[model samples]
Target chain A: MEEGCSCIYSRMASRFSIGLLMILAIVLLMVRVLYVIYRCGKPLPKGVSQSFTTLIVLGSGGHTAEMLSLLSVLRKDRFTPRFYIAAATDNMSLQKARSFEDSVAEKPAVKEASQFMQIYRSREVGQSYVTSVWTTIVAIVHALWLMIRIRPQVILCNGPGTCIPLCVIAFVFKVLGIRWSSIFYVESVARVKKLSLSGLLLYKLRIADQFFVQWPQLHKKYPRAHYVGCLMIEF
Target chain B: MEDRENAKRVVFVTVGTTSFDALVKAVVSEDVKDELQKRGFTHLLIQMGRGIFFPTKCDGADGSLVVDYFTFSSSIADYIRSASLVISHAGSGSIFETLKLGKPLIVVVNEDLMDNHQCELAEALEERKHLYYTRPHTLYQTLKKMELESLVRYTPGDGTPVARIIDRFLGFPDD
Candidate 1:
């Protein structure tokens, strides 16, 4: 009778241990997510300097146009060594960036601005969640390698799925005391009511050094998001 | 207008980067095929995205409907610029570019799209007489009355606001 009782007790103890482990795993995940969400401090301000190397992402089609409009208006000497990041299959973005460079090249003045731009293509993500996860993992690895090589002082991107891995990497770098690469997240003009997936992730994780919105309504919706009007290059 | 008349007799149909099966199906329908031929569109180039349905090569035996299609193209700006007429899914990327290029554009709003703000945009632009707006289901009817001359010249922005933000961010105050 004692032997059967002990056997039953051992079975119950094993089940209890499994339940405890599940709870422990869930709790750890929650805490880690919350930490990532709330631990980040506000962005550090930096004066504009010629030595500042800026990295900006052009997310395929519309984002490419926005990038062009934004880039065209800047003073040529402000951001030295500007690097443009785009997705691998986004040849349109690359073409637009190249053509923008060409436009500067054709100009008699500020010809040096054309030479400051560099383009890099990251892995293209698909719509499927499963495939996107795999591509994102690969992209994270690639972005880590690029961050190591580029060592950019500041990184800026409008909403795109491709921005998440790099922003996360920037967050990791900031956390590790390895480098202080400032990240700026700009929500696209098209998103009036809700944040895009990239915006949501950055907002929830509190990863961006600065967050900008195109509309005032969005600014009211998210107190953390800054509103500085819009940047649409529409007809 | 004279330039459009002299441009190549090609109709460019782009679904942007998203698989829009409804738009593709409507384009290849027998009615649309016949109408395009009657309108002197010598070629129909469709960027179908990942859409499964594609019309077979427009063999002369099947009523002079020359069809060419691809799943995706990274750079279709030239296709948008060079064509006599542009048919597109109402993605802002396509809408703005088409408007900028002053192409005769017909935009179909995918009603099922989650952020189908495209529908509202198309309606606004249609009211402004910039482009032809049609829902996917009603595309055939819209095409029946389609007139390229009806498309209005879109007013271009000064591109000042975009420059301001970047300059402000980079420490250059607006001039």
Candidate 2:
């Protein structure tokens, strides 16, 4: 009878210890998340120089145009070895990107600095919701693979649905201490009053390191977003 | 054919990548054509994207107005650059491209599109006197009332400020 009572007590003690460990782990994770969020938008402790590989996500039409405009003004010499990712379904965006690269890349170094990659869109416009679930999984897997391969130091994206997966993977990498790819999201000039779905997700979740909006109204709406004025025009 | 030496006053109308049938229809109507001729626009070029409606009264129409249109162009920059006036759908891409070129622009907002954020951009630019915005039904009136001389030239926004912020975030010292 004593042996049976001791066994019950030991089992209960082990279970209680396990539960306590889980709670402790949860608290640690919460603290870590809070710390990471606090560090967002601040300069990195160890800043990288030269050989900075940047990953640029290009959406179709307007998004691509806006992103290209932003890149036109960015110091290309500083951000070298760019990897441009576009949706497989979007044929024009990467072509435009390549042309833009060619236009800006006068030297051999800048000329050889760009590579284009295509990923499947999570959900194409007008696609049924039922089939999109499978595609979204496929897209997430592809995004993970690309993220691991590129391991970019900096990521730049505007309002594009394809960017959501890549940004999320980068955030996970940040949380895991694998890579700290600073994500910079510029809300499209078209979105004045409301954030796009991708922008809202990254903003609410604090995935993007720095969020920029073209209009002052968006800056007012999303206090965290930097009001950088319209990005479409090149000075 | 009338005067080779005189610069042809071209008015470019772009619907961008999406099909804006209402915009295409409104721009090509007889009233709009008459207004174009009255305004001394020698040529009218329409970029009708995937729209089923094609203006039947194009090319060599009895009057001095020469109307031509294509479904798509590899690059519309050249067209926008050469145009004296630009009539465009309220797509932000189209709006900025025209404004950047310093062309007198009239933005036609397609009300049919759901979740249309195009109006916000169009209205904002219109408020700034960078361009004019109107619905398809009122495009003719907007065109008639447009004061190209009064329209302010758009001063291109400098990306230096944004780049500086990015540099700071990347821990690069400002030069």
Candidate 3:
């Protein structure tokens, strides 16, 4: 009789675990659907009729150069009260940004960035999967902090893997009525043929408010993304 | 394409700060050596830069001429100035430097790199008649047909390309 009771208890425990797992899966799916519905095939346009607060994500190396070029293009009064964000290890970007700002300081129409701060890198494309998961979680928390702290009206980033977590957090902010931020993702000019990993993820998942491709070929392929000409004319 | 290799031409094979064993190996291979020798390149100065492999026996190392290599040197600008033909990894710094000097450049893009941006840059320049480019495996094949004098000088653009499109994107008055 005791053996029969033990077997029944084990079965009940297994059923409870399975039910909990099902609920978790269902909840995850619902959130994903909500996010998708919020993001995909829908253009979140924030008309820049007047200057608004801007957050620009700067990736290391080429991305820094490209963003600098973009920033160099825009008038100071247009993207006022600018905030620059980069990965903590990207000292090169910081130096370049500082020098660039200094170079443009002499101009009357330049509105310098309010602040440029570094955040921890989420995960590199080639890093191990396990470490990537932990790093991504930490990145999300960091991004959440920035999103909450800055509450930027518009966020601009080129195709960088580091931008993903921050943009995802922005989506969470939007969905939960925490904040409203427009994400403008520009695919780098170097991507002649296809959307980069970041661009691909943002495109398929419907994360970016405006997705701009430098090449018309890429625009032809994606159709949704705009062809904005050569961001880097050298390339 | 003279057979007599007395060395007016310096072939600078620079890996540009990073270790590129594939590029080093390809440039040092028998086919590449023979091509360089045939092209009258006297000295092959390799800025190997942390690359493990070295040329087993340099082209004409037995007194006629020699191949020189260094781990790292700050004299990259000096090398680009004198090089008859520059073969390099598709690093932007190296590319721009070589372009600025108006030297014939053959860039070999590192296929194992995390990004293909460098490759795109090389292709664009190649399209614009600015430089010749190759993958590591086909280095010899590409080098065989590369024209030294025909490579165009690079022109840096003026400051106004970024404004109009950006203005449009920002929903600002596109003046």
Per-residue accuracy of model 2 over A131-168 as CA lDDT, tens digit each: 99999999999999999999988999998889999998
- Whole-model lDDT, model 2: 0.88
Q: In candidate 1, which residue pairs clash?
A: none
Off by over 4 Å in 1: A1-48, A88-92, A105-138, A175-178, A204-206, A214-235, B1-10, B17-21, B33-75, B82-84, B110-129, B144-153, B170-175
- Two-chain complex of model 3, DockQ on C-alpha atoms against the true structure: 0.18
Which residue pairs in candidate 3 have backbone atoms (N, alpha carbon, C) closer than 3 angstroms, thus clashing? Answer: none
- Of candidate 2 chain B, the 10-residue stretch with the lowest lDDT total is B56-65
TM-scores for every predicted model? 0.67, 0.95, 0.71
Candidate 2: list runs displaced more than 4 Å.
A46-48, B4-7
Model 1, span A52-127: residue lDDT tens: 5677777867777866766666554565566777776666676677778766554556444432232333334336
- 2 versus 3: better TM-score goes to: 2
**Which digits, one per residue and each the tens of the lDDT, describe model 3 over residues B1-175?**
2544443678898997678899888887878888887887787888888778876645553644457788887568799999888998987667766876778899999988875677987887788898998999999888888776777777653335445544555566556
Query: Which docking category, incorrect, acceptable, medium or high, applies to candidate 3?
Result: incorrect
Model 1 chain B worst lDDT window (10 residues): B158-167
Residue A87 error for model 3, in Å?
Answer: 2.5
Go through the candidates in order and give each one's C-alpha lDDT.
0.72, 0.88, 0.76
